[model samples]
Structures are given as structure tokens and as C-alpha cells.
Target: MSPEPYLGDTTRTPIRHHILSVLVENKPGVLARIAGLFARRGFNIYSLAVAPAESHARFSRVTIVVDAESAPLEQIVGQLDKLVNVVAITDLAPRDALERELLIASVPVDDDNRLTVLDTITHGGASIVDVGATSVTVMLAGTPDACDELERSLEKFSDVELHRTGRVALPRLG
Candidate 1:
């Protein structure tokens, strides 16, 4: 028999993003087990972030951005629910959630473009984090779309090194 098609095959299903906020006991190997499940099942995880959820360090919140085309949302959630450490899972729909990502970029600059680069960065609502002899580094914490636009704008500068933290989200209250 032919191998099963990749769950997120573009031709089979249109791509969509689903953000899942998972709460789990803060224990070793829990993250590894979750990642192993995705690897074994061929699910596509677009982005993931994990951090302590409480000061007591008893639980962690894992934010996962999944490729909706990879598998049925219900199926994915059901599989995650079977994990022993997973305490709860909440799907944060775009409209019902608030999401943010952090972007840091270092762009080469010179006498001719330093002012212009600063202008662009400030105008984009990013703050200058560092200034070196030949480059300037900027930081922006914003919605994914805003970060995308800023990244595109920086492409005009050659040798720009950009890093972005994957999205972290929470459901909106009220």
C-alpha cells in the first residue's frame, strides 16, 4: 500500500492556522512526549512556545500554532488530551484571542543610511535596542502581522539578521 499522504499536503487541504493553548504539569519529558507524538503522527506544528504559567512552578503553558490542514482539529485535540500530563487545552481562535510575537533585527548601516534606518525603525513602532559601529539592532513586540510587515520592510537592507520568537497567545476575556 502507498504510504499515507502527509497530513498537511498543500494540494489536499488549504492552509489555516489554529493556536492551541495547552496547560500541563511542569514535569520533565512532558514536552518531549508531546513533540514525539507530533513527529510520529505527521502533524505539522507551525510554531510553539512554552513557559511557566504560575509562580509556584507547578504548571506550564504551551502555546502551539498548528497547521490546520495537517489534521482535523478535533482529532489533534483528542490525541493531545490522551497525554497524561496535559491538564487542559484551549483553542484560541484569531478573533477570540490576543497573540503577540517578538522580533529582533540587526541591520547594517553607514553615515549615508543611519538616519534613514533609524527613521524606518522608529516609524515602524520598533525601538532601537543597540547601536554598534556599523549596525543597529531594533526590537519590536507586536502582533504577527505587524512583525511580518516590518520584516518585509527591512529586506531592502542587505545583511540584515532577523530573529522572531514564535507566537504566544491567550484567549480574550469578555
Candidate 2:
């Protein structure tokens, strides 16, 4: 379904985030064009993930989480629609979409905090992927909120490195 045109509606409050599942031709420079379009229009993207769609490599799906507060949702979609490579754009409201994110962190551990770190990791539903003499690497694949919580819990470590794969989502089927 297309989004309602947001023409300066002061009475209505805008949603903070809007996920756009964009289908595009699998070709070089398509991403560049899309990024350039957002840059030109000054729309802020919160998270973006792209991958080949279905069994064929002829098309790719781009899941873009846009900051709705940054620009009018209608204009963002309109600019994206103007691109020739873009096949289709589906705006998925947070409730209508199922989203997931992956976060990997390598946190330092000493005798003092090793047990506490492991406890935090297990409590957060994260798996210990790798263990070392000085650190442990944990992987968490879950909802965005869960990942954020796990990250926050790990911040007590002095040396922790985190890498997150920005959100990827699909429309929920009734």
C-alpha cells in the first residue's frame, strides 16, 4: 500500500522510522544512484541492508530504514520511484514488519570480570562464538531492542568492539 502524502500536517505526529523494502534490478551503480538520490534530497537513512531476492540473481531487495522525521515520507518514496533501477517500493510500518539485526562483539576479559562477562552474555541470549586468552567473541542475532540491550550490557568492558549488521525486515503475512 502506498503511504499517505505528508504535506506539512502539523496536527499529526510522524512516525520515527519507516522501512522501505525496495526491489531493484541487480546491476552495478544501482546502489550508488539510490544513495545519491537520498543525498541529493537530504533524507537520512537509519539502516540499510541489501541482498539478492529469490532464487534468481536478476533482482535485488534493499531494506531501507529511513528516519521519517528527516523528510516527508511521500517525497522520499517519490524520489526513489523516479529511479529506473527501482522496481518496487513497499513501505513497511514497524508493526507490519518483522525485523532482525545481528550484532557481534569481542569484549576483553580478565580474571575479575570473566565470569561476569559470560553471565551477561548468556543472560542476553548471545552465544560465545570464540574464546581467547584475553577476550571472548559473542554473537547475537535478535530483534533490534535485544541487540541494543546486549550492547549496553557489554559496555562495562574497557575494550569491546562491536559490529552490527543493520536491520533487515520483511512484511508480516496475515
Each candidate structure's TM-score, on Cα atoms with residue i matched to residue i, is 0.87, 0.89
User: Against the unseen true structure, what C-alpha lDDT does each candidate score?
Assistant: 0.81, 0.85
Query: What digit string (tens of lDDT, one per residue) describes model 1 on residues 41-81?
Result: 78889989999996859999999988878888888899999
- Misplaced by over 4 Å in model 1 are 1-15
Give the TM-score comparing model 1 with the true structure, all chains together: 0.87
Give the CA lDDT, 0 to 100, for residue 21 in model 2: 93
Q: Write one digit per residue (lDDT tens) for candidate 2, span 1-174.
A: 212111222112136789899999999999999999999999998988999998869999999999988899999999999999999999988777777778899999999998999999987878889999999998887777777778898988887999998888887789
Which candidate comes out best when scored by TM-score?
Answer: 2
